[model samples]
Target chain A: MMRVAEGSYAIADAVRCCSPDVVSVYPITPQTHIVEHLSQFVANGELDCEYINVDSEFSSLSSLIGASAAGARTYTSTTSQGLALMFEVLYNASGMRLPIVMTTVNRALSAPLSIWNDQQDSFGVRDSGWIQLYAENVQEVMDLTPQLYRISEDPEILTPSMVCMDGYILTHVYEPVEFLDPELVKEILPPFSPVNVLDPEDPKTFGAFADPSWFTEFRYLQYKAQERALDLIGKVDKQFEETFGRGYGGLIDTYRTDDAEILLVSLGSIVGTIKDAVDELRKEGIKVGLVKIRSYRPFPVETLKEALKDASVVAVIEKDVSVGYQSALLTDIKGALYNTSIRVPISGFAAGLGGRDVAMKQIRKIVENASRVKDEGLELETEFEIFDVNPECL
Target chain B: MQESLFAPGHRACAGCGMPIVIKLVLDAAGPNTIVASSTGCLEVTSTPFPESSWKVPWIHSLFENPASVASGIEIAFKKFGRTDINLLVIAGDGSTFDIGIGSISGMFDRGHNITYICYDNEAYMNTGVQRSGSTPIYASTTTTPIGTQSPGNLVRKKDMPAIAVAHGASYVATASIAYPVDLRRKVKRSLEIKGPAYIQINAPCITGWSYADGDTIEQAKLVVETCICPLYEYVDGELVGVKKVRNKRPVEDYLKTQGRYKHLFRAEGGDVYIANIQAIADRNAEKFGLLD
Candidate 1:
């Protein structure tokens, strides 16, 4: 049924439809409504799982790690410091190869402790070995919730995953989202039977100590599973689209880059605004296109190369900065093009941190600067530029 | 051969009472048990590679999340509709009394069907005798060494078994490796209950406590006898079982055996510290009816 619903409630309903056997939750801003709705569902007999209200995000993820190990489909939601508090168990979940799905409402990490939106929290633990997926809208949030489970629980890809959505932009916004039929979700998603579980009938050890001899191999196996997930993600998304009537453009969603002179790259909710700016630029006869990256961890290097092959300059627009250098997404995008046949100049513009509005003017400036850099053969002094920096504050 | 869930080929330190308590608890738990261990001595020593001494299912994750992980396993079994297997957690004092308390409290608060056994060695033994929250008052550790300006650790030891009971654990017990029959009976009784149960075993550390090579059992007995670490059980918020000490001794008997407390006897104004330590034992004796 398609109805106007808040993104959090929509996601909660989508998760309930997936029928997770265990839902562990610790409330944090922009992420609370998702779990709140899920808890109510469990309370009212709409969902039939053990709903645990944990004391902290640490325990929330830790319990999920345990539940996943024991062969249960588990889900949780958190943002910003909540995700930061869960940092250690994040690695444990993936290292143990438990296919727990988490909805990470993207928000900025704190020293000043802002409850605003940014990709910093999700990007901070990029190397924790979980598959990362960014959503551009509420519909994507609802659609991708079940697909994430399929990809994470796939025998070839038994790794934990985080479905990242811009905190308030997608998490709190109301939109009409069409949920896939519950019958279809059950038909498509199989019952979780883990390859290794804590079964006393057939006892086996999990997360056991490995010496120098076997330690590297364990990590290597985790890495290999991720490498294999690159293909599995595309297959799962395609399967989801075939089962339902919608498809997110595999790993990276490209917007009219066939013969563009400039490409603006972004992820999460800002991708929607960037797409709007791209349309306005195209109507003005400017050859500007947008590429929305959906999967960030198993970064779509080949697909990105093929998508941006014809662009003369690519401008990366994102929400997180690596403190002293280019944004994390920009760095990965540049690395994706390194030593390849594609030789287009790529630059980054970081904006919309701490929930600051990413104005269309800032995105247009990115396109205009990249176009000028290509036309006049000029090189940027810095690796990437900070978009919309207030010189008055400096 | 006796039915054993924990094998003997692992590399725990000689005279380390933790492994003995672990073996006894697991034996009582039986082969139909799954263990979630925190990162500490037992985890490091038992599974040191492709080799593991655990005869049943076991998992070792971070230090502060054994109870949370065990809670997950317990809930997972319920989700799978299987109630036959026993869910057990084994963690050190650092994990139990300090870092893992919040998680343990959460596990108990949620009322999961699992038994958590904390092998209390007082200090962080695996990390080379660092002072932890469970380290006794005025006891010396590497981080709380006796010096001219220092009087060892300043804080009192956390009463973990009471903490479990306060968190509404259905069964909470304090046991010692010195009394194997009592420890085994406590473990069996905890497993018999169908909710969160906590059993804290005062397992003495030979290296950390600077004790004799074979005095682990002796020291465990002395602490219980002195009421410094009383052996008692709580069932549904009521203290029903108490291991009454027929020959209660002064706290000096237990303190004299540990080198960590040696400074309290030899230093200037040391008797004050000794009296303060005895006061702690006196309070426990009064509270648990140990002297009677």
Candidate 2:
């Protein structure tokens, strides 16, 4: 049934359908409503699960690590500072291969703090060995919730996943999301049958210290599991589509990219505005397109190369800057296309940072720059530009 | 003898008091228990990669998360309706009194049906005897080394059991590795309680304390007998039991056994610090009614 609901409620409903055995929560802005709805579900007896009101984001994720190790499907959500506090436990969760799922409501990090939409929070922990998926809108946020669990809990890819949605843009907005059918969700995501768990009948040691001789091999296994997730993420997304009849393209989604001379690449909800800009620019005879990267970690390198192969110039727009370098997604895309046969001028534009608006005009300017580089052979002045910055601010 | 749940062949130092405390606690907890250990001496020594001393399900996560982790397991088992199995957290004093205190406080405050046991070896033994919050006053540690203008650690041990009681834990107790029966009884009793329970055991570190390998139990006993580390119990924030000392021993008797306190005897004006320590023991004796 398609019903208009807040994005957080849609996500909580999707989580409910998946039947998590444990939900540990510590409230943070933009992520609070998700847990609040889940807590209500538990309170009214609609959801029979252990709802742990933990003390901090650290404890919340730590408890889920324990709960997930004990063979329970567990979950939690947090934004900027909360996600930063959970930095240590994030590595532990993936290192232990817990298959815990978290909704990383994306927001900008602290220091001159802002509680607004940005991908910096999720991108900051990009190398923590979690499968990171970005949603373009509220519907995608709802649809990706169960798929994250399905991918993370796969027997071959026993890694945790972060379903990142732009903070207030997707979390607080009202949208007509097609709620997942619990019966069909069960088909794709069965009851969590753990390969190993904390059971008295069958004892096992978890998170044991590895000496120098063995430590690298253990890390290698974790890396191999992440490598395995690149394929499993797409396969499970396909399975989700087969069962639910709606699917975002698994790793990377493309819009009018074929036979285009210029391609714009980005992630999260900003892709919506960029798509609108692309449509306007196309009417003006600018051969521009958009490649929405859904899965960021186990970064869709091969699929990205294939998508941007034929472009005359590729412009990357993102909400996070690596600060001293180009945007994170831009750097990854540059590295992906580095050794490949696809040789083109790639420019990066950092926009929408700290929830600053990435309007259609700014996106149009980025495409015009990329088109100028392609058509008139214009040389860029800097490595990347902060696209929306006012000249007076500097 | 039933086969010990904590198997041998791990790498704890000879006469290290932690293995004894772990063995006793696990023996009391039995096979129907899961353990969440913090990163400390016991976790590093007992489970190094491919080898684990635990015969029961055990997990060691971070330095200060064992209590929260144990809460997770306890509530998870509750969701499973498997109330027979016990959830136990075994951590070190560095984990309990210092870094892990917030997580522990949260665990107890939430009233999770779990028992947290802190093996207080007085310092951060795994990191080579750095002074921790549980380190006693005037005792020398790597972080509080004896030098000019410095006798030793200037701070008293943090009262973790009292803090536990303040959190409204159903049962809070302190034990020493010197008395196996007393420690085991407290472990079993804590498990029997309906809600959160806390037990701190003063397990002497053979290496960190620089004591003779064979003197761990003697040092443990002497600390209690001198009224420096009293054994007592609180039931729901009320003092219910105290382990009385029939004849109180001099504080020097306990201090002389460990090298950590050797500075109190050798350093100039060391007698003054020793007298201060004696005063601390006397205060503990009077407060706990240890002589009664």
Candidate 3:
């Protein structure tokens, strides 16, 4: 049934459908409403799970590590500084192969401190051996919830996943979300059957210290599992679509990319505005299209190459920057296209950072610049420009 | 001979008190137990990949997270209806008294049915004898070594047991490796009592304390006998048990045996520092009524 609900409630309701055995929670803004709703569910006896109210984000993820190792399906959610606090535990969770799922309500990192919609937090932890999935809207966030659990808990792909939704933009926004039936969710995500666990019947050592001789192999195994998840992510999304009748294009979803001369690549909710800009540009006889990246981590390199292969130029737009270098997505895309047959001039644009609005007009200017690069045959800018910067501030 | 849960093929220092504490704690917890260990000498020595000394299920997460991890395991077990299995956390002094204090406090305050045992080696022995919150006053550590202008560690040990009690732990105790019976009894008792329980065992580090490998037990006994490290128990916030120090020895006898305190006897005005340490013992004796 469809219900008009806040994004946080919808995400919480989606989690309720999965019926995790343990939910460790610590509150941070944008992520607070999700956990609060989960707590209320537990209090009302609607969700039959152990609700652990932990002291800090560090403990929240730490407890989930233990809970998952003990053969419990576990979850937690946080954003920005909270996610930064959980940096160590994130690597630990994936290294232990615990299959814990978390919702990273994406927000900007601190220093000037803004609790606004941005992907900087999750992007900071992109290499922590987790499968990262980005959602463009409230409905997509709700839909990706069960898929994350299914993909993370797969027998071959026992990796943790971060289902990232733009903080406040998706978490605080109200939308009509189609809640998945708990029965159907069970069909897609069966009961968690762990391969190894803390059990008296069968004793096993977990998180053992690795010596120099064997440390590389341990990391290699984690790498191999993550590589395997690239295929499993798409397979599971296909399964999710068969059950729920809604499937996000497994890794990279394309809109009017076929036979397009220019492609705008981006992730998260900003893809919504970029798509609108693509439509406006197309009406004026400019063949601009949007390539929405749903999964950033096992970074759909092959699929991305295919999507951008036909375009004359590609514009990589994102909400985060590497500060000294360019945007993370632009860097990754540049690396992905390099040495491959897909030779196209790629322009990197840093937009919507720290929750600065990335309106359609700004996206149009990005495309207009890319159009100029294509028309003039200029070299791709090595550094990304802040898309909507006010020159007066400088 | 009965088979021990904590096997003997690990790489602990010859005279280390940590393995003894681990063996005793696991032995008391028996076969039906799950252990969460923090990063410390005990964890590194016990489980070096492809070979583990543990016979029962064991997990070692990060340094400051065993209490929180054990809390998760305890609740997970509860959800599985396997409350019969004892959930235990074993960490070191550095992990307990300093970096891990917040996580431990959270575990106790939340009231999970888990027994947390800190094998107190007094310093961060795993990282080359650095000073920790549990390091004794005026005791020389790498970070607090004797210098022209310095006098070892300046501050006293943090009162972790009292802090545990303040967190509303159902059972809180202080034990020593010299008395295996007392240490094992506390572990078993903590497991027996429901809700959160904490026991800090004074496991003397032969290397960190700069004592002879053969004198690990002797050092353990002397610290308690001098009233410097008292053995006591609190049941539900009440002082129910105290190991009285009969024929109490002076602090100088204990301090003279370890190189960590040898500087106290050599430095100018060192007698004043020794007098101050003796005053700590006197306070502990008076507070816990340790005198026979």
Candidate 4:
């Protein structure tokens, strides 16, 4: 990331520095560059590891699961359809407590074949036993990614880790990133020593049937492991700051929200653009700020309630939907506000799908609508719904 | 030597063939082996609340990750930070030969130190006798019910042992509850092997197959004896061995033993049933040299 570093390239460098022993990847648009760069590194003997170019996303994850069980530090990357294909594997990796690090270039799932920046794809895997981290800029992509191995591989948090960045926005854009030295990275992350490994020297068995008798208890264990992961995110963040010089704001990053009456809440790279708009609004004496979400899984309910406690109005801008219900991330934020004395009205806005541009101008308009709603005591259910699809090409 | 890993006394029906297979398999695996089970009848009926049916240290994960769980358990032993446990996974047809296919294949392709055993009764008997991929051709289950024109399942049974071998598994074999001694012997061999080894057992079901409780063991033997299903093994991803199919009879004998294939021979076009069974046996023999 020393030169004209694209966001995806920075992520690729972080993955290589993390020194994942096995990388199982399947390519999909906008997200492919991160994997492609990593693959090239492996091919050029730049990364000393097993790089599996899988037949499909399913195989990609399957390969990682195998490698993880073999006690190899594994990595994988995907987006949208690719993520959907690895849906079952996500559960398998977490259930088995394999600390696999994956990069998800967030994109929309297809019905009519959309490939755009959205929270839906990453949000879809919210319940799986994995520590989820969202990166808002190329620097975060470079910085937070290697942190995944530290957090995920922690014995107390032996869970899969996902570093999600906006599909095309952060993945395609070039930004100056200060690449951490490999020696420093090695000192920071340390080697992965597995609790379990599949080896022939000592015979073992896996993937047996758990009849109705004892299935619940094991599921409870998976659930508990995820809970353990939430705490480790902060613990790892602290150690990261000590070595790397910058700390990730646990769960959510707050911007100028000290006396703000209106707050823009979102995740992924959109937060960068929204932060700019928040600055612009502040210049005009507007009491507006931005909250960039980091972790989505083990969604920071208590932490978020504390962060947004004083805000008068909160606007949720999402790229994914719950269909007849709320947008995916908005629902979690609302649940965090539940039973709290802070009665900040929240509005949900769905925008950007099918590779469509989520321009700063569009985000500025959404922020404006949100600021206008703050004037009244009302919260709109649907505002800034800008993802209306045009007719398909002939 | 495994001292019958499953403790005696669990309700697996009056003539539950699986527990017996489990007992023999565990005996073959010997005292050092560990078992991971899936969510199914064997796991549910044996290890009910507050108690377990196992004498050995056993665990039950979800239906899908038993192989993966076993993979973990296997690696744990390899790391043996201090344990000498041998990992063994016992699943029903629904879980092993089907739902757990990916993890199983992964373990095999990676050559993990684990053994996967599928106690196949040809259906998802635990879930009320539904059709699974391993359900034999012309088998009758809730999902593959007998109809006016069709007998039952039209698709051929999946050759899971062969699939395991093709994945470069160290060893793969088919076993039957009818032959406890041989089944135990195979288990012992699989346990001793260095990489992923798979064993498929034709454990009959009294309720699912609509057979008399007494006939469970009888049908399991008849299955292989009739050549409808032959016991065999694939070594090093190649068809290197076969079990004895002595005095092979018509597929009808195996079919008529259970109600699953009752519709096959009873239907008007049932005459075509022999050709299908013959085709299966023919392919099995040709594929691995099982019969003359």
| Candidate 3, position A262, lDDT | 82
List model 4 lDDT by residue over B1-292, tens digit each: 3255567888788888888888888777765666777779888777665566766556665676667556544543443352455678889989887777876776676677788888988899988999998887888889988888668888888988768877888888998988887788788777777788999999888888887668888888888877767788766766666776767777777777777877776788877876788778767666656665
B89 Cα displacement, candidate 3 (Å)? 0.5
Q: What digit string (tens of lDDT, one per residue) describes model 3 on residues A104-170?
A: 9999999789988888999999999999999999888888888889989988889999899999999
Q: Write one digit per residue (lDDT tens) for candidate 1, span A201-254.
A: 788878788888988998999999988888988887888888888899889888
The 10-residue segment with the lowest total lDDT in model 4 chain A: A200-209
Instruction: Report lDDT (Cα) of residue B205, candidate 2.
Output: 87
lDDT pick, better of 2 and 3: 3
Which stretches of model 2 miss by more than 4 angstroms?
A376-378
Sort the candidates on TM-score, descending order. Answer: 3, 2, 1, 4
Q: How far is candidate 2 from the true structure (C-alpha RMSD, Å)?
A: 1.1
lDDT score, residue B131, model 2?
95
My TM-score estimates for the predictions, one after another, are 0.97, 0.98, 0.99, 0.82
The superposed Cα distance between candidate 4 and the true structure at residue A328, in angstroms, equals 2.4
Worst 10 residues of 3 chain B by lDDT: B1-10
Off by over 4 Å in 3: A380-383
Report candidate 1's interface RMSD in Å: 1.0
Clash totals in order: 0, 0, 0, 31
The collision pairs in model 3 are none
Tens digit of lDDT per residue, candidate 4, span A190-298? 8998766554445333334455766788788777777776777777778778888888787788999889888888887778778888888789898888887888886
* Residue A303, candidate 4: C-alpha displacement in angstroms: 4.0
